[model samples]
Target: MERCIDGVCSGIFGSAVFSDTVMQERLPKPIYKKLKKTIKEGLPLDPEVAEVVACVMKDWAVEIGATHFTHWFQPLTGVTAEKHDSFLTPTGDGKAIMEFSGKELIKGEPDASSFPSGGLRATFEARGYTAWDCTSPAFVKDKTLYIPTAFCSYNGEALDLKTPLLRSMEALSKQAIRILRLFGDTTTKRVVTTLGPEQEYFLVDKELFMKRKDLIYTGRTLFGAKPPKGQELEDHYFGILKEKVSRFMHDLDEELWKLGVSAKTKHNEVAPAQHELAPMFATTNIATDHNQLTMEIMKKVADRHGLACLLHEKPFAGVNGSGKHNNWSISTDDGRNLLDPGTTPLDNAQFLIFLVAVIKAVDEYADLLRFSVATAGNDHRLGANEAPPAIMSIFLGDELTSVIEQIETGVVKNNGTSRTLEIGVSTLPVLPKDNTDRNRTSPFAFTGNKFEFRSVGSSQSIATPNFIINTIVAEALSQIADRLENAGDFRAEVNAVVKEIISKHKRIIFNGNNYSEEWVAEAERRGLPNLRTTVDAIPALIAEKNIRVLEKHGVLNRAEIYSRYEICLENYIKTIRIEALTMIEMASRQILPATLSYVRKVADTVASLRAADADYSCVKEELDELVTLTSGLKAAIDKLDQKIKEADASEGDSLSHARAYKDVIIPQMNELRAVADRLETIVDASLWPIPTYGDLLFGV
Candidate 1:
């Protein structure tokens, strides 16, 4: 119940987490030091040390009134999964005693077949293991000790998102260290990728949400007419929060804070009913875990306040969709942000090298970057005016772009010194943080010290995107290190590498509007791959170059790569299939019937008016329009049904099947929606079966 408005609430923050502070306080010094070493250095945990740590963890959990423990992990389903076991062990005398073992703490067995393995494991091959991820702290949730873990199959293939993510983080760190050594940074042992995921979502009344079958079934309004008043006036952005929403957010922050999630900022988003929560940055692994927990907590807290949190990328059309802006940066264990362009960026050779490496990675592997954010839900949001385009591009602000330009050409020009902004009134203070204007349209934008990846879907786990980024950048860094380590002159070699990278990858940098058609044509001219849909983008995962880089870094082997490709395609097809079926059911059962009733009422009114011997021209015209719309709706429904049947019966590989859904079935569905939405505009509000967009959007 503690609130953190301006000052820190010392004891309330991380109250439920088994954090490093908790370990230092509760655990013996030697055991705590050993465990810290294992966590920081990635060394194998000593059995004796684990036994002592497990005992202390169990005691702490029991002290906090937890009777059960669970190994929480992130699976391919894009959510956290766990199986709980009680602490009580039955003694021979029929009495129970609390017990926990090092073996149990270190590993767990979960059924792998039940989860999506995508040909990695057969139905009968159900074995999977969850090993403790010691770096991320455990926490108490719902009277259970939740230990973060990494999931894998019996043959050691990654069956969950966390396994590959952890591997990719290691890969990035190893290569980044090598690059740092080339820069004479021997004091730094590891370089870790850090992330701050800004989550955007919508809150709707729970009662209204339940009434909408599409929202319940698909997490979006599959068919709804655009409301008269949307975000057209741009009044919702940064507006004052409503009382109910403020209460929900306060509760949400408290819940997240208990689990050690640094929920820092909350504000209204660009869309009605839409809001955003931004957390402080953490190491990539812990940040991913905290984000997953934050999302779950958001929904749970909303429910308590009689609301449903909608995390879909586009829950409503004609307004802004939600996105998780991944603020990503790299740092060393010894406290240095690699992407930090200090006061004089031109003098910071290390920062320039790292920045160029990111640019090169994003340019060369644009397809892979596109694939990471590809999903059926996101397909509707990307390339729209509200969201970034499907084309991958980076936006380095004026200062860095000028630096890069100087590096590309052999001319170093002083791009004017930073100046303070003055207010017209002398009483007002000057602002200092306005070094550069922000471009929200860019997919990847440099925001001062870090890059913000704005194309990630709201509901995504963020693990895949960060890992893909880590792996690609690691490859670029590895290539740079290879040249530098063998060079006769380190400084000269660094400059040569930076220049070559800038020359090759400068096309990916654009400060203009990405949503413009001209940019699309320009990107095509520059030979940038524009994978516009989930179907178009997912194929990049299996491309030879992508596979080679991933395998070379040991992030994913060939089989693992293929499995993920299959899984992504399968998930896309299934999502579309479910959405199509839901649309068909709603169109035929709810919308068609409702419109037919309204049409019958209109026809009856027209007949009665004609029989009354009065002027019935307006009534007749309304009747004619209703009849035409109803007929059009019927025809659209038939066409959609036929297309769905054809898609269901089509035979091909996963990619081909997905193509059919995307190319043929989706168009048919859009046709059906057009007719249904028109019907909604004409039909009476009482006759409409489901909640309309306005009600769902503004009712909360």
Candidate 2:
């Protein structure tokens, strides 16, 4: 394993990865320098340079016991997709030589029709290309060398998350550098976005997890009565870890660390058996890759520890669900945190401009942000007390809000000093979250520098949300740069823009409780769109303004946008359909049969009591109650089955089909679950077909 040097991160951090340290150690100096320059400047790798890097990378991977290589890419299916190829090349003899070429390293073709292309290609097209993303590092896992790549169609349409994400990063950097030049910072080069997504999950005993068919089919529990004690006492949060859970975490961290993922923090979450792991910040695209790898490693480690890790947003009902809080920020290559309120006059002026750009961007394109995190699993979690509300609002905290207010009113008042956050104000105080009452309820909150997008679901890939953030913020900065670059008095114009931005976009900056009903009502009054569901949020991707901005910034073309829009709806429609089918199957095969068996036993007891000439009223009453619930359960199953069949048969567009699932099918699923959960409480433990919520949550 690599170790830290001089107290700075070096080989110890990304030891297993084909990281910079390994490249420097192995590659010839000229080739290494050329490769690094190309990556840093976001330029295509020269063929000769790629040839050398590929050979060195292959040797490193082979040395690490990697026999096969995979082009690891994120498809539109909201998960990663990869196609593995062996490194062995036949040498015309019985034996073969391990060989990998620059062409193989730079690109590969896979069957495009199988993955969700969202009509970007025909079913018979069967061709997709994976281009090597030289920016993100390669790593070896399970004897397979996984090279990070950007997937696209043969026609060059982005069919994967990383492609658009890379485009957005470049788009943002282009505009940000323009902004930086206006501020007279020419040596900054590239402005890179960073992300640190905190992942939350639940770990259950593997046996208990397998017993529940719903947990097996869907990631969440379809039907389980609430356990008596939940997160109400808040004792589980940050509490002492159980020995088994601790062992799992330890193993998880080790695995993730070897893969070069910065699995920084681990602790108990609000719910029983729930835990969270947060990583240190990394380049946005690399962070997304690390997050996906982290989630995959988490499950593998848990299974080795005799546990099953649940990444579903709402794995259990009536408890705190999981969320992936994306902490995002941007900084210059020369090491300047753009969001930080710097002490010097020049620094303060630049920070104020960038800060206002984010404020204006969030206000103008809140819909895109919401749509970024939209998912069928997340629907059950959002707007709940445990997670941030569905409404898109920013929490700037009280002190920051005060600074913005002073800027808005043109009053420079601060603790017996004429300090202000307004641009062009030479004397300013660097007060970073001194009085920030952090609001967990806010969807997007400013925690000192970075904005934590708390609405992202745990199971989701962070690429989509981050790309949206990058594009929107880039658009805002582009608009500001147009004014600043052309203005005769740049500083005065910067101050004016900052003031106008805060004044106009102040509605997005809320320092109050976001979970309150008043906040919802006030959000509506402030003309904010409350897109509360995945279906409701999906259309925002294709909205006119969103499309315009995305095109203007060259992040995603209209066709690419429409394709993703189709995919999102399709994903939602399929997810609900699968869940509904799973419910119908569970109720009919498992819950109903077991329930009826218990009902028969109860009826037998009633008959015995009556025959014995004893008071039969109590036993008879129990039998009657059982029968009633059993009837309701049967009826609920039939209704869900019918609705699913109808949805499958009668579909106009994916949107309407998705609405049928959301509006009609989801309500019926709840109705079915209610009756089935009630039966779990009354039925005998031994007679029950599956493990109860208590067992799944606490048995671990």
Candidate 3:
């Protein structure tokens, strides 16, 4: 399945993208400057500029073999959506010409009722608008001009994740820029949030994948016995890639490069059949869009290599799962990273201000932050091996923790554990980004310059987590800016503010193992939120404090917030319901039937041995084990089916329904899976009914 992409060239990186370079090369200078202004400053796009830009963009797309165009947008379904239309328009003289108009480029209407709106759009109110978001680039994908856009309902309520995400960005920028001005930084225009999300996934043979109905229906194995050799040897982490995997990664990188995605780092992850890909940073919205594209393209590229890419948070049991580390930072328009703590007093104070602001933000809104990454798939991954716990805490490493403590207690103390590197000449001894060793077990760890939110699941959109991040941090920065905007001595106020924040919110900072039971008790003692699952976390979305912050920043309206809460509850209920049904089907229709056939064979052998008067004790023992398991399997299936009936019969409110699924159905489903997985160990390999963990994890 190796693909030989011919005619590789120097210009292949963004060949398909209508990027800034492409825009600059093809557009009139005046038009290009105006468009850049619109993109940077969040100004309205002028009709004349849009017309000219549309003309140039169409020309470039046509040159690259585009025949149709789509208003590509991200909806609340946690995925991207697009509808294509031909560029050809008929003439009165029975001839047609290809054209793209400014009106067309700026706006499109897709059916509102079709997308998940969380009741924002009624079924009969089938109108929604997709407005062009000039911030993210357009690219030619699959012979179509894919224009990135923001979707909204006819009433102007945000219907897609992109709209709220963009709003949160603007909110953060407005507050952050105000803080920059107080630092006497008049040259900086905009302060934008950047994200460098690392993606992790599993690659299994497509043929083997198709054999497992559980994987196909639920995106995770419902019943997998522990493999004889899992990732226990620790040999798979950073191991040499298989030949087929190497070719897949090579083609994947090239395809992503053509689409202007900066897929930077690729390596074997901690589990067998598991891998990770990290990208260079981009603006938050663009990075969100790029991540969606990356997930889509990963599946396509995997299929081409005869592999099935598993992006489920817990695709396999008894081994490491996948997570997307959300690396977040802020930067000024003129290229100064706001998070970088430099040597000078002004820079260090500024960095600490933003740093404590994040600490304060995460502390006050830890529950909401926990809620943002909540989903059914992630429930299995969180608090498990290779994934952080459900509790929200920050890891600042020893060096930075000491710096915060000195600011807090005014008594300098250091832990003996130390490592030093010259990142920059810092008034406080500087440590390079590498010196602060990565805390893989920490849920929210501050890397050298950015906060890596590690709770995000691999298959998630990242829009919710990032929007919540931007909104909460914006609230924190807004308060800090208000405190300092009128200060007579701004530098003096900065230190006081940072110290005050550390005193109050430093409880959120913990540089210890988040996975330990001791840490769980410690987190409870500190009153930190330990939202264990999506069902436990969803109610935080509608909490008055969370709603107030979201509203204050205009990231989401009250109605939108409630809609999201309802949506979260429904999504959780539906996901578990589907998983429950899938388990029933696999156990009843496949596993039990297959196992029974084997049981019947054993019974016949035992009977023949007894009739022959040969020693039948061993044969009787085997038959007894098979009979007991078959009876248990049938009873477990019946128990699961009855619970599903009760859940359906009493399905009332969304929250209650979700609880039914989570409390009753999920446990019963697990009970069934336990018996089935045990049966797998005893049954013949060919009679096990489906692929085992050994086949799925190592067959490739």
Candidate 4:
């Protein structure tokens, strides 16, 4: 692999991608124009044009050393899936020729029974279709051409995340265009939600990762003692990267760039072993695909450098956990960001309407927003003082917050003039991009031109959260458009609508600290829903209001919404069950035996001191404490084992199972961990079976 320096790397970017530029060069003029129109305008793809484009795409992929092809889709399993097939077809002469057709490129068949369907499909009805999503470009990787697609059942039910996301995008575009037309903007045909998801992960030594059964089985450490120096001083944030980690990041960027992923920013995170990678914004669908690729490439690159990339939300306790900051914004087809608050946003009615639409949407569908990022792994991070709380709120900076206040009060207050900082030194240049102080603790923060959704889990897919955002905002925009379309006075109607939204939904906008207990109480008093766990939040998916919004926007039907609710609950239950089982195994086979051996050693030391006629008080005290800890450890282990057995025996629906796991089994697991962690503190490091927090955090 050849390395290109930063300045000379522009040419290498998108080299392996079948991008629009490559399509234009390789495809005929008419075919390229038709395909681009289909992609941009969301029109039906012409089969004749697809055939020509497919042949050209095949030639380009083969030239780049691709021998096989696959329709890559994101299923409901929260990860990507693909099935590869060689491009070879048998000839009459016993040889083979490489060939690809428009039909094959446009469709794929994968077994549906193998995936989680939430009762949408039975085992006998094992049929699913993968249709090519032409909007997201194809790319070549590992001698294969990967075409992005959306998966669905034979009956047309969405079996994957991409289908609903695409539907939501179209819904949002339609409503946004209506609003734009009302504002006298006719040239813009579509509105696209753009996203820049900042990925955070931890890289630990491969040797250490392999030794921990908890990490290997559950993707998180079920049990580990806290390190002495665990981000306490906060020195690791933005610190210089070590040579080994830097090499891994370099290779990761190169691989991502080849696939046309805009890998832009890299830096150390607050945790010692954690790091963050942020890309430039792209359309929502493409950004989702690129982010998935970035995460896969991050692990693959780390493996080559003899490391294990941990994307689990709470890979370690007593430190900052990882989160994917979804910086999302909306833009017009002609390149105008709707969220851009120009010099005098108070006077910009168009921007104000769009802003209030978001506020109303977030306030109305706060439960849906909460459930979008809910997962068993994320439950450990949320409200843990490191990541955002489970409660959903918006953080419009001081300027926007004040604007909303004025609208609510029906008083136009002048916002103060922008001020520039003057340093004492003459040579220092003034900063340019400083508009408002950033709020890291806010879950959904409006930072200058975009709202950063900070509640998304690192390991989870961004497709669900983005789709929810699109659908809710579309509903709000639709309501505004309906009122304005009938109003006799356009300007008066616009002000009335904006003021009404501000008055009703202003409670969701909180500029104060979201991590504080005071805010939690205040939010409860304000009638905001705080869903603190995956199980608690998952039920909101099938709420009457939520289903109505989704169905009205054509994003998802009622059946699909119920199916997803079941799937989420089932997934959460399975995840916690696996973690509990892994904890049981580690405690029974590793921790208990090691603690017993240490107790024997301590007893021996005390005996020797007494035999020598010396004061054995210290040694005797140590042995007594060891005995007490061992007793507590054994009792907790037995209790956890009993609870696991009870949970396994209890048979019920997915919701009941999940509730049992959360309400009954989790408390027992926590008790076991408490005792085991205490034992780890007293036991010898050499006897401990798994890697300690210090080694995993600092060894890299």
TM-score of each prediction: 0.95, 0.97, 0.96, 0.95
The Cα RMSD of model 2 versus the native structure comes to 2.0
Runs in model 1 deviating more than 4 A are 1-8, 343-347, 414-436
lDDT string for model 4 (1-700, tens) is 1122366668879899998889988898988989988998998889898888788899999999999999999999999999999999999899999999998898889765789877788666779999999999999999999999999988889999999999999999999999889878888878999999999999999999999999999899889887789998889999999999999999998899999898889999999999999998899999999999999999899999999999999999888889999999999976688887544423267777888899999999999999999999999988888888998999887766765676666654554643321111111121122355667889998887788999999999999999999999999999999998999988778878987898899899898889999999999999999999999999899999999999999999988898899989889988998999899899999999999999899898888989999899998988998898888888888888888788878889888889999999999888899889988898888888788999999999
Q: Pick the candidate with the highest TM-score.
A: 2
lDDT of 3 by residue, 464-485 (tens): 9999999999999999999998
In TM-score terms, candidate 3 sits at 0.96
Q: What's model 3's lDDT at 693? A: 89
Runs of candidate 3 with Cα error greater than 4 angstroms are 1-10, 413-426
Stretch of 10 with least lDDT, candidate 2: 1-10
Model 1, residue 211: C-alpha shift (Å): 0.4
lDDT of each: 0.88, 0.89, 0.88, 0.88
- TM-score: model 4 vs. ground truth: 0.95
lDDT of 1 by residue, 1-700 (tens): 1123346655678889998889999999999999988888777889899899889999999999899999999989999999999999999898999999998899999765688888998666678899999988999999999999999988889988999899998999999999888767778777888999999999999999988888888898889899999998889999999999999999998888888898999999999999999988899999999999999999999999999999999999888889999999999876578887554423267777788899999999999999999999999899998899999999987766865776677555554743321111111121122345688899999887788999999999999999999999999999998998999977677778888998999999999999999999999999999999999999999999999999999999999999999999989988888888888889889999998888888888888888998788998898888888888888987887888788778888999989999999899888889988988998989999999999988898
Q: Write the per-residue lDDT of candidate 2 for residues 589-699, one digit (tens) a residue.
A: 999999999999999998898899989898888889999999999999998888888987984988888998898999999999999988888999999998888888889
